[model samples]
Target: DHLMLYVTNGMGEGIEASLLTNLAINALRNARRAGIPIADQAALADQAVYAHYRGRCYLSVLLFDFDLTNGRVRVVDAGSPQLLRLRRGVVEHVGFEAQLPLGMFEETDYVAQEFEVEPGDRLLFVSDGVHAVASPKGEAYGEAALARAIQSTRLLPAAEVPRAILRELTGHRGEAMPDDDALVVCLDWRGRPADR
Candidate 1:
């Protein structure tokens, strides 16, 4: 089994990264000791972030736990809009329903969900920056754009997936730099190359 937790402050003003890292690490330790599921650990992390930062910063996290035996993927998502699956020739969004971001509420309840992945499946976990792009018409390049990008590269090696998405994101805005911090994570199942 493997667990992946991702947290980023996204170039927010007046933020200290060390504090976030410490809180994440502590929450991870606590989760390990408590022997709880991803949902409980997410709630615990929410409390830690809330108690420490008090909502002065924005936090988005995606927790993924993968079971090697059955190819089951467990997800505990907190206020993120970018979880995608690309299979065959179609791409789909599998993100969690809207939930409170960490540090926004002390008593927020987080839920863990699951997905079944196959050896050739490609999973993408992106930060909000990828969707925070806008055009001259004031429309942000959204999920549809992302799905198209993923579909175009779905059959290639994983190393090319994230790069294609970034290209599509920048393509939406022409020459303008991304207004927000961007992150793209691509995971390829057996025999696929893993890329950022």
Candidate 2:
């Protein structure tokens, strides 16, 4: 279980923020009822148990689950960043096709896709804020940099990849404050023997 978390500043103030928070919670509850497994059960449970405390703050969540016994990987992307999976040295994005962000609509559905995770495969999920970071020269960090960041960490444990990306981003931006929230979740699947 590896998760990267980040949140960015928003232009909306006060009341509007509350509305979005409520909407997001309702949307996630709807997703749970609709059969989308949240991957991190404890975290979701905590959110449900204390949802009232925060009122409604807009945020996104990204989850990654790996079942070593079956070589299956499950991800729940809720208005977060796109998740990338690197298998046998090739990198590709995985998750439901574009769906509404949590809390924006009354009813929403999310699709879960599974891919065989070989012993050396790596997966990376990142928040949009990371890609949104702009350099002094004015170019956004974009997909190319992200892909390269993941590739550099291909041989490391799944948990380290996300941190590597964060470090990379920090190096790129120097002292500037990130414009948005960013998070990364990485999972490395090391298959186990059927009997184990």
Task: Give the alpha-carbon lDDT of every model.
Answer: 0.72, 0.59
Spell out the clash pairs found in candidate 2.
7-181, 8-181, 23-103, 24-103
Q: Candidate 1: minimum summed lDDT over ten consecutive residues — where? A: 6-15
What's the residue-level lDDT of 113 in candidate 2? 47
TM-score of each: 0.82, 0.64
lDDT of 2 by residue, 1-196 (tens): 3222222122244776555555545545564566546543323432542353342333454434556566665655555577777888788766564433443333344454455667766656677778778887778988888888888877777767778889999888778887765667776656685664
- Relative to the true structure, candidate 2 reaches a TM of 0.64
> Model 2: how far is 9 from its true place, Å?
12
